[model samples]
Target: MDTKTVTDHLYYPVSAQKMDRGEGVYLYDSGGNRYLDCASATFNLSLGYSHPAVIAAMKDQLDRVVHLTSSYQSDPINGLVQRLVETSPANLTRVHPKVSGGSSANEGAVKMAQHATGKTEVITLFRSHVGQTMMMASMSGNAFRREPFPLLYPGSMQVPDPYCFRCFYGQSKETCGLMCVDRIDDFIEYASSGRVAAVMIEPISGNGGNIVPPDGYMQKLRAFCDEQDIALIFDEIQTGIGRTGHMFAAQHFDVEPDAITTAKGLGGSGAQVAAILTNERLSGLPAHHHSFTYGSNLLAAAAANVTLDIVRQPEFLANVRHTGDYILERLRDMQLRYPAIGDVRGVGLMIGFEMCEPDGKPAVKLTNHLASAAMEHGLILRTSRYGYGNVLKIRPPLILTMTQAEEICDKLENLFMAELAR
Candidate 1:
């Protein structure tokens, strides 16, 4: 009731404008102003806000039962496990749904890899935002994330990501000979504790400038992991559940990882749920080692079941691809008109564009400004990593129609015209 007092007591700052409700891709505020949500409400609304199917399923499940301990085998959990195993890569036959969120799912995968390999270290790509949990924050790419904590998780290291736009090795994709994968040997040799458990990665870097790996990168990485006997884990939390047109990015890239961690978009209309899908080798970890209280809630499982059914539809995924391509093409055209847009990269509906100075340096301030100004154009845009990076992400809901996609581009055009005019 006391809005000012509540706002003052909150740990993190929030916008002055309060949101009332959401539908599909649009969110309405208290004043009834509707704005297109390009960030998909933290990139978790794969089916958009207040999705009918998800709501109906949850409502139905609510009548039957809402809470049951994970010890009991409920229909919702059973269906969710079956659906996940069926949709994930063929190698991922086992599904572990007793994880609370993306962070827990990812940590469980690492624990499985460690238990399987008897190793203690983890290798993640530079700039990757794995999670905010203590362990994940320690393993993630950016230094600023871990700087605040004194006693950080040990035995984790970061290697150069396959960001072709500004290759860390200073070689172009043509003549680079995949130096990024090859050089991991050096990092493992000198930088790690020698006993590396897994190589975790996001197929397309989420919150890391939307950096799509160069061609053959995933395959080469797979081979490298195999050669090293290191478990390969795909952190598909942001890219999974139809965000990438494919059921999983592993399917899109055609390289099966030893394990895949999924969350974020799996709940469709924002139910809190997450799971870790693993092959037989990485499935030996006991449930007690990594289970959470809310891991297998019946209500969340019901929401996930309907979400999976909708996203698994061939037509639904096809529309995501088509719409993504259309938006990418429109952004490329804008890139030519505005020199500030240094690059545009994406797969399916997960897209981002770099804001750069005339000299090709990261335009961090400009990117932040655009995100803040986007609301003026009736659009809600979010910058990568809360403005620590120079990329503006345009990842709308997967259910976006062609007309809505056009509207997004048009609004972006007007935003650029007003802000970036020569």
Candidate 2:
């Protein structure tokens, strides 16, 4: 069949150019055009494309078995569980590897929270994209995502996130005394059902403009949750597995949450796996209550085990921090030259810069246009909130070297020069 026919038969729209293969951080089209993928193939691929270590591990597991029921114990699964607990925060003692992806992991984490707290309400931040599952879609903050579904999750509410650049309370970070955390009291008392079970948040929001919380925000939130007996869940799908220079963002923030949902980068070279890590208190949910058919595949577990081993290395994580700092520095320089570059924020390789109009409104159209034009400059870029937002994400593979980091910044500068020249 022709490529066009195959594409037409598919359920979703795809780019006209056919990507033939991927190696390291570069994806090559059928025409032999190489584009440095800044989005890391949906923000997974911490080890870049076809990583040798992940592939070898999967190959070794494939020789013995690929999929097995989670009811049975296996070497791969046992190794994965042990490694996850060892690498994750000290408080997260249990690992639930029965979830298929980030969505299910997040939903499972919420279920654990609900089960433990005996509460129904879940709170998230504005512009957050927790997932696309029916419950997650409803729970997510953006109105556009939940607009089509007439029946929505009832007890989910959104509070203002710590986006100091465009603060919801119109207060600066310095003198505001962290009103973003303080104001949640009003949200819980008035907007919510009062029996709030969980407050799930991304340490650095995956699609919500990559907003990083203020210095003391997570600690304050932890205290607030403790005060209210609410379970704190970190949706670390996009920020985990060395993406943030740490095994998990929870480690980076130095605040332990009640639970964490991890996926995306866990597969390293894209083997399809996810898991929920929780404290003993939230580990009461039975395996049957939140397990998928494909959840405990031995092949994926093999991949994850190797992925974790490689990512946990101090030198590997240090490289992520160094490369990320270099890119952030370069982007900050770009911000100085480019007035449209409103805000630059990130940690490790997960970075984003918001585009703004001269009047300070979101430059949504401009953001989308640049993402489209990026391919011409040998770059692959993705817009935040699946294009409803004005932030262009710069989360490349964690395996990115200093030279590759420089290349990304140079190409971005060229893209801006060609398109945004005054």
Candidate 3:
């Protein structure tokens, strides 16, 4: 099980040990070393590893049918799509299912918007990560990720993120009046050809430092898009399916987008399910414009259906909100004790804390050091290495308990103290 010799060197220094099994938020290595998964294994396993319900659903589905192309209808398709729509925003009534992964979900979404509007230009926030596919990667805002590639797909434009903590526009949320939204008019007028189809935004920026846009910022974008007749696409590929306490992070903003991309946690426990819930407006895309070979896989759909059934429960979401608030409060307390802890922000289980120096600049080196050190402490912590090497991404499974939450904090406290003290 030597991954280094077998796989690409994308994630360098890959773990030598192989994880044999996972159960209830903890993963056990081949040597029986237990590791607490704080990042939900790339934020995909919403219900934690080997969630009983998710596994049961998958086994049940595999017995009936394992794989089916979307050309023909399947038993779980309608039921899963129905449950998804019921839990999704009211405006998004149509469902386009795709076999797992966020990159595919976002690529399909952007295609639909372009197809429906007969437009060519698209807009995304700086630092917002759309996906890993060629077209989607070109559309992303992180320049570093796309630097080595030769000429990505064009027609994608960038805008300032509503990062109030480290405001890109150098203005405070209180007095700035949401300048990020105000710049769209100029970008479309001067930068674009006016054939803009959609403006894709992360209700909460996932890879972009876990940034939560200021209040009224999201509503402003929605209204502006309406005035301009542009489709608003919310990229909740990382924040959807109970990651943010809400079934979708779009709900937390109290506004709706024309379409929303979902993946990651939709399958409950790393099941392969990704989709784009769209409105009737964007359903005009041609039959084969945004198709996938295994788009409506029954096995993953079965797990996804069960996952949504449990996550969308009112009581389950309530518990998430309660527990998430508790975790946030504890993180804030850590901020008080450790000046290295710069900022804490996020909703529900999708939380992040930025590491900073005493003078308030991002402690990039310290963050990298601490993240690596935590693995030795038997906890796999997701930090800004994926984003920018400053913020720690702390998204546990939706099924995490209070005791597990405390363990995470305590473990991190030691990791931070040891690494940041010197």
Candidate 4:
């Protein structure tokens, strides 16, 4: 690709190299150089690249048919919905599919919440990122992503997230009485004016540096929302489908959300599909208010069914928990050895390590430099824009083995030592 072509069209510059193939947990470039796919293409390839089951399902779907525009019903679509409902919380029995990504799923959830309650306002946590679409962008707390789209949407409010690392309230996780949850309730009381439809949250903050709240945070939010008659929406787009060693992150807290949104790993390793799962009370709303043409396409549905089957297995979930624990322990050791590592936090496979300068201020530049350096060492990692962009996100596939986790942790330690010497 030409420089002008690469630079002018895309928001980010496209690297010249092209991916040739992928298998298991590795990807190869056109030159046949293989790299360990720790990033998992933004942490979506849960079953890893080119799984036989997912591929077979898609091929079988192709042999039957591809699109059936929601005007008609297809077996795969029905089967996928049944599988989703069976795997999700008992109350979340209704499903609305979408052909877009996580952004669209968030948009759909917001619309449903509003339609069900006739409320105009919604609440989200500061530093939380829902999606990049117009409505989702408005709900997102990322200033950089929302700067150019100030009037993107209306009736979205932000509150303090339960980020114990750099607590806005100046309290440690041990001493803090979940003032963050109380703050959320206060915000709802003052901001809602009885016009709020939903309070959307990441059960465990995903894009906001994998910030896991204090124990009972989610349960408290659920109880508060119930008392206030506001819907609790869980943006599980990043934390669902066994990424957090559970079918849904809300399961970890044993709290049920009125609505939950999912995408990414839902389709395994192929097709783009997302869904908004709601309870019967929420689903009783008029159907004419929401519909999508390719929402329940047969091909995508088939892939999703297969993906859910694999992720819902007892042995598979056990593997996820085991691997996740190993990774977290290794990260904790790194934090002890490197002063640059400020905090290591997260649950299951979704983890983050905050970076800081010797003087104790967040070091955004150093974090980005480390990510670039890791890429050079054939390990891909993500940098969070939240927490002043000082957190390194490590969300590899749930299928990653213990040996692979050791390799990643060892490389990270070596990289930190080398950078400190420099």
lDDT of 1 by residue, 285-340 (tens): 87789989999999999999999999999999999999999999999999999999
In candidate 2, how many clashes are counted?
0
lDDT of each: 0.94, 0.93, 0.86, 0.83
lDDT of 3 by residue, 196-239 (tens): 99999888888788898888998999989999989999999888
Which candidate achieves the best lDDT against the true structure? 1
Clashing pairs for model 2 are none
Answer with 1 or 3, whichever has the higher TM-score.
1
Q: What lDDT is obtained when candidate 3 is compared to the true structure?
A: 0.86
Candidate 4 lDDT, tens digit per residue, 1-422? 88577667888756676889988777888888877777677678878888889999999999999988776678998898898899999899899885467887888888888888888789998888999878888888877878886477889889998888889999987888888888776776677665788999988777777788888888888888888788999999889999888898988778899999998889788567888999976776555566667777788889899999999998898888888888889888877878789998887788888899998898999988888788667677788864258888887777788898888888787788778556
Candidate 2 lDDT by residue in tens digits, 138-216: 8898888988888887889999999999999999999999999999999998887789999999999998889999899
Which regions of candidate 1 fall more than 4 Å away from where they truly are? Answer: none
The TM-score of candidate 4 is: 0.95
TM-scores for the candidates:
0.99, 0.99, 0.96, 0.95
The number of residue pairs in model 4 that clash at the backbone is: 0
Over 4 Å off, model 3: 1-13, 385-387
